[model samples]
Target: MSKPRKGILIILSFFAIYVIWGSTYLMNKIVVTEVAPFLLAAIRFLSAGTLIMVIAKILKFSLKITKAQFINCVIAGFLFLFYGNGIFVWALKYVDSGFAALIVATQPLFVIILMRILQGKKIQSKSLMGVGLGLVGMYLLISQDTLVLSEESSIGIAVIFSCVLGISFASIFVSRANLPSHFFVTTGYQMLTAGTLLLIGSLVLDETWTSPLEWSGKAQLAMILLIVFGSIVAFTAFNFLLKEVSTEKVATSAYVNPVIALLLGWYVLNETISVQSLIAGAVLLTGVYFINSKKKIVIFSRFKKN
Candidate 1:
């Protein structure tokens, strides 16, 4: 690809992951109101995963995987999709989407700690400062006097933190794991396996599986957006960036997403953003910037989409 075309594609991919992925918090919040969370997640992933597989085949990409690769994909899928995404959606029933997004933005902070524990990585001074600010930001965000911390809301907050941890671990795992070389193939397998497991989990929990035909028009539209743009488009762009740009540059999405989510949630859903939340967000994002300041992007050979 020429430099000009590559630059344009990079900008577009960043938009997909930044704006589109950010909007998903609001979309999922809307859909989860009527659809059971696990069921909704299963449907979204299953549909996106299937569509991705068909697209990969049509593009003549090999779909074959080794046994070890398949197992790794399953583990990744479980960590990333089933536990990380699925439970996060479930938490939407109790938490505002904007609030959840703010908390989830602390993922980089979690990643640093997890890397230290699991990989025996040393904490840099900059990272330690980031962690400190992140903790203070979190305390301010969650301990708002204006906010009512109901038991359900407290549980939702806890669950969202766990999801962040799961996603953080998955990121580290994927960086080192052996998997399909093609992003499309790897994503398809991960989503498919995760979606299947989510389905089984939903059934086991005896959640009412409502048909789309019975859902509100708004809910249906939200679900469609979640499946297509959120899961397929944004995620594909993310993987694409991982190969094309530095991960630190891609990590900028962490700062952008919460801002987008907060604005959209407030504008569309009338979700209140307290002054404390805003202050916390500023502090939190600053910490994330600090943590990412010195990292380099690990780029790979660029691949063609078609």
Candidate 2:
């Protein structure tokens, strides 16, 4: 590919991740209004996973996996989707999507600790500072007053926090494990596994299924957008960008997601965003940047002369 073409593709791929993934919080908020969280999550993953498999087959990519691979994928799916995603959806009923995204944004802080705990990696002082900042951000975002609103709300915050930790561990595990060379294929299997497990969970929880015919236009649109853009296109783009660009650049999505989710939540749903949430979001984003970055940003360093 020409340099210009490559750059354009890279920009578009980043756009997909930043915008699509960010929009998904709002999408989840919309879908969960009528559909049960587990059922919605189950269907989303099952469909997206199937779509990816089909696309891979059409492209003549290998889709076959060993029995052990399937089992590993199942475990990853359970962590990444069934708990990380499914529980987040359920929590949205109590917490605002933007608030949930803010909590989810603290994922890198957990990842830093997980890496140290699991692999015996050394945590740097800056990384420790980042973790501290992230904790304060969470406290501010979920102010004591907010937590005292109801027991359900407190549980929701806790569940979302757990999901962040769950996904952090899942990512570390997937990286260490021997999986398929095809990233999408691995993602497909993980989604399928999570989808299947969550489907069972839906039945176990006695969640009612609302027919497609009965879904509101907004709900239907949210599902379609989430399946097509959020799961397939954006995720594929993210995996692609990991290969093409510096991981530091790709990690910028961590900061961008909350802003997009917050704006969309406020604009479309008119969800109220508190000043504390904004301040906390800023702190949380700074912490994530510190966690991902190897060097101090020294803010506005781009303007410095070489």
- Per-residue CA lDDT of candidate 2, range 1-306, in tens? 798997898789988987888899789878988899889988898999999999999988899899888888888888878998777777777776547756775776676667667665566787667667766766676553432234477788888888888877776666556566687888788888889999999999899998867999989999999899998888777655655553334545766676677778888988888887689778867766665564853320211111
Show the lowest summed lDDT stretch of 10 residues, model 1.
297-306
User: What is candidate 1's lDDT per residue for 121-231, written digit by digit as tens?
Assistant: 666777667656766676666566444445589889989988887877776677667889887788899899999999999999899999999999999999999999999
Model 2 lDDT-worst window of ten: 297-306
How well does candidate 2 score on lDDT at residue 182?
A: 82
| Candidate number with greatest lDDT | 1
Compute each candidate's TM-score over C-alphas: 0.79, 0.78
What pairs collide in candidate 1?
246-297
Q: In model 2, which runs have C-alpha deviations exceeding 4 angstroms?
A: 1-18, 91-106, 135-145, 149-161, 237-256, 270-282, 296-306
Evaluate residue 208 in candidate 2 and report its C-alpha lDDT on the 0 to 100 scale: 97
Instruction: Give the residue spans of candidate 1 off by over 4 A.
Output: 1-14, 90-105, 134-161, 241-256, 270-281, 294-306
What is the C-alpha local distance difference test score of each model?
0.78, 0.74
